[model samples]
Target: MLKSQRLIRMIMIINARKSFTVQEMADEFGLSTRTVTRDLLELSELGVPIYSIQGRGGGYRLLQERLLPPIAFTESEAVAMFIACRSLRHLSALPFDEGAESALHKFYHYLPEDSKTRIDRLKDKVAIWSPHRQVLPDCLRTLMQSIMVRSVVAIEYRSTHGVELRNIQPVGLYESDGYWYCPAYCFLREDYRVFRADRILAASLNESIDCREDVEQRTLWDLPQERAPLIPMSLELSPGGVHALRSDQWFGESIRVRDDGGGTVTVDIPSDKIPFYSDMIWRLGEDARIVAPEEAVEYVRRKIEAMRLRYS
Candidate 1:
């Protein structure tokens, strides 16, 4: 069994009886005596009321009236929660201003002393670099409320074309590139569309019923996570370009290193983001080359030609 599951089971066993011996727990869980002792120490550090007694039949027992709900977490899960809480703690717009603070307080107190110390060390090492953002959008909370009830809402949206009112049924909300986006079913367009949260000038609940039957079942995947019609791409990067790819915390996940020295890597670039890739490659100035997807090659040639003409 997983260690976390075993810890929980151990707690149940201890709580069921007035006392448990180290040998008995080791036999029950197929663990060594040292492992069982370590488990008890970890539990105690998490504020469990375990106490020891010395005698012929001596073992460990819980302090009277000090029982707590069994709780166990793997190291990865605890770290993930800490990272997420750290990311959201600064956002002022999320509902319940004090909720994140309160939760972090509880989570920090429950963490083992060692884990707490490790998290504190990580605070200095890990960083999420993004553009500054407001605490919340003008209508984020209201739009979220409408999404919760599957209610239609009338929104005054400022699109690039012009300002217009739209009646929409919100399906989901997401943040990307330092902006919030709401994917909703637009009554006027009679199709699903993504609306910038900041671009929403105003919003009000509408009496119109939400006609989207699968609103609740919709997922973020319903929107594009990557460029549509994903294309196979290959590229050769100079040593400098390779360093750029490896240094990007997000891009490094998708890159396959060609050698131990990190001299080259193969990655697929979204077709819709080719223009962006072209710009980055240009910055590399001969250090990056698109090796496949003839279309990307042609696109880059056209961009270079346009640049030359403009400069001429």
Candidate 2:
């Protein structure tokens, strides 16, 4: 077990009883007596209110009414939490940055002595690197605040088309590929839409109307539909196509890997993306046979012929 996790369990073990011998704790956690003694000492340093008896029959126990609420966890849970906190610590912007830091500190400080040592060693081993790191959106905090109060917010947003003012009911925020997006009820469009946080030039909450009561809770899929209808599509990839799928991560979530190295990838692509996928397959210069919606197959063939004639 990870020392950090063991430390948490140790607290629970000791708190469950009036007193425990080093042998008892060692037996429970599968650690050596010396290790248990070191853990108790570290717990003492952290103000766990432990008292130790001396000489024969000596053991450690917590003070009366000093028992904290039990927090039980499996080894995997502890490691997962540790890794998650480690990743979040590197994020430039988080809605709960301070809370995340405090929680991480508590997680580390209560770790078993060996686990602490392991974490120190692992710190250099693990890292979160963003190749195209974005400057955290300045409006993120304000947008979060607005969402909590269910207030309408006005934002000066810049998109590929142009800059415009948007009055939206702040709903929620999510991170995708390291960028944050806010799903909001766009007042201008009279529907829900997702806005990129980084594109929000400015934002301010509107206190006049409470739009929360009327806005139904909806998942990402429930968001307003796009102009292009979704269509069933499937593809048969060659070795290179499989490599492209793995490396490029294009339409990855829709892919299902098969046992024989090749996989079945079927998804409902937006009608507009059919042409895009055709162009992508042609660019791969690999043998990927289209297997569906005869339209896509014909589209790709024409593009290939066009390229062939251009080269010829």
Candidate 3:
């Protein structure tokens, strides 16, 4: 169990590293080939970097920015990237605007025959994404350029609350669930921070800012804790509560689903939003309960009183 978990983490964490074949990995790790393959599929569902390649010339390669020149995308890959980009256009800085006319022109020029066929198929099946629409065009372009160049950037940004102006040095550009983000160093806070691209009022390439040695590995797969103090606890959730965990649309990553039936969820969060998380549990009422870290029960009590006062 520990070995498979380790393999999953290895494959998931290094987005750029190539993966061993099932036989190679299994033999090296002393596991059955089936188990190794299973772990790979599981990693894929969590949006890990693992992907399969075909042909006698192909095996598996995890994509990293610096190694590959402008890449040729298969139809599925291109459409997947476009879909992600479309979503990111809303939430983060986009280095390219609708005017990716040039990039799109370049992108189309490199398509393999198979990828061209796939693009046509995807055109027949259109998809849409919803994100905060305020993000600007050039912001995205800078993000793309930064990701490709591994360059540092300076951004004058406003917070989600629209109350703060922060100057930050971006480390990497990222697209998470259709939103574009940069996890970077904040000169003001002197801490690592995540900034939505859409919120940046202005940006420029800042040759002065460099990668910080203090940066830590973070899971875009799992959101980092909030900067503000929060009450952390675990809770059991109901069927409907589990359904809410499907996307960050309502509740977020803290309320995670477990088991296949959408019957159990685990949450760790702040008392500030007690009503938000706990009331979600209370609404599920009998279906959810505080399971660990006793402080959660009081948070829930506060939520109940707020609900009572509101109803009264």
Candidate 4:
């Protein structure tokens, strides 16, 4: 085989074996040990992270951070990846913030000049907008680590009520409306709850609490199934309200438009979500009228009255 082909194949083999003697590479490639040693030296110079072991029973092994084999990507595929990373630039914080930035920089730096020009032109035309929220969740990495190991974490959460400490087994995390949410099995509530990541003041492993075996298989997608009993709710929407809510991720699908350009949102949501839905509908003012579910109506009325009294 050509030297370049041999070197690439050797890199793959070394990555898989992780620890091997020079003789192993020579035997695998049917080459002389001298040639294999020279190739290994060349690989090391190319940042392959190869290190020799001087003692008995020790062989050359890659460092903990092994180099990845080169990958070939089509122009379209490369552009897609660049755009995907570009889209995430709006978020205030990311679990892999530094890694993402570095990767994007490296990827862009090596692209052909023409491709770079194309990307620059498209930057003005294409965008995936996410709301720019200022709140940063410093504990995002800790929370992510807990999810990976399925471990219980004790967290100091600052909610509207007050700061409270709770032990939780995180299911998964999701981003919506410019905020990160961690859905977890809360030991305090003994139920599944969604906590805003920004509200998490601190998080650390809690060895005192055992993670629930039942929730080990749970994920963010399974949250709807884990909800309390659903309660039917309906809203009558004017034309303006229909237009305003058409973009709502949560309620957009529930709206049914009429010939008059008006619409109605009718859906069953868990009772625990009533307060959130009420606040959303209340913000629509006259454009939206709550049609059913006296609970939500009452909540909105109480809010309106409270605001009135506060202003008075």
Cα error, residue 262 of model 1, in Å, equals: 10
Q: Candidate order by TM-score, highest to lowest?
A: 4, 2, 1, 3
- TM-score, prediction 1: 0.51
Model 1 clash count equals 1
Per-residue lDDT value at 61 in model 1: 87
What does candidate 3's lDDT look like per residue over 136-241, in tens digits?
7687677567555655667767764664655555556665455677777677788777787767887777667664544433334444467666656565666665
- At residue 164, candidate 2 shows an lDDT of 95
Best-matching candidate per TM-score: 4
Candidate 1 lDDT (Cα, whole model)?
Answer: 0.74
Question: What TM-score does candidate 4 reach?
Answer: 0.82
TM-score of each: 0.51, 0.58, 0.47, 0.82
Better of 2 and 3 by lDDT: 2
- Higher-TM-score candidate among 2 and 3? 2
| Local error of candidate 4 at residue 194 (angstroms) | 1.7
In Å, residue 168's CA in model 4 sits off its true spot by 2.2
Minimal lDDT window, size 10, model 3:
63-72
Residue 31 lDDT, candidate 4, scale 0-100: 92
lDDT of each: 0.74, 0.74, 0.61, 0.85
Candidate 4: C-alpha RMSD to true structure equals 3.2
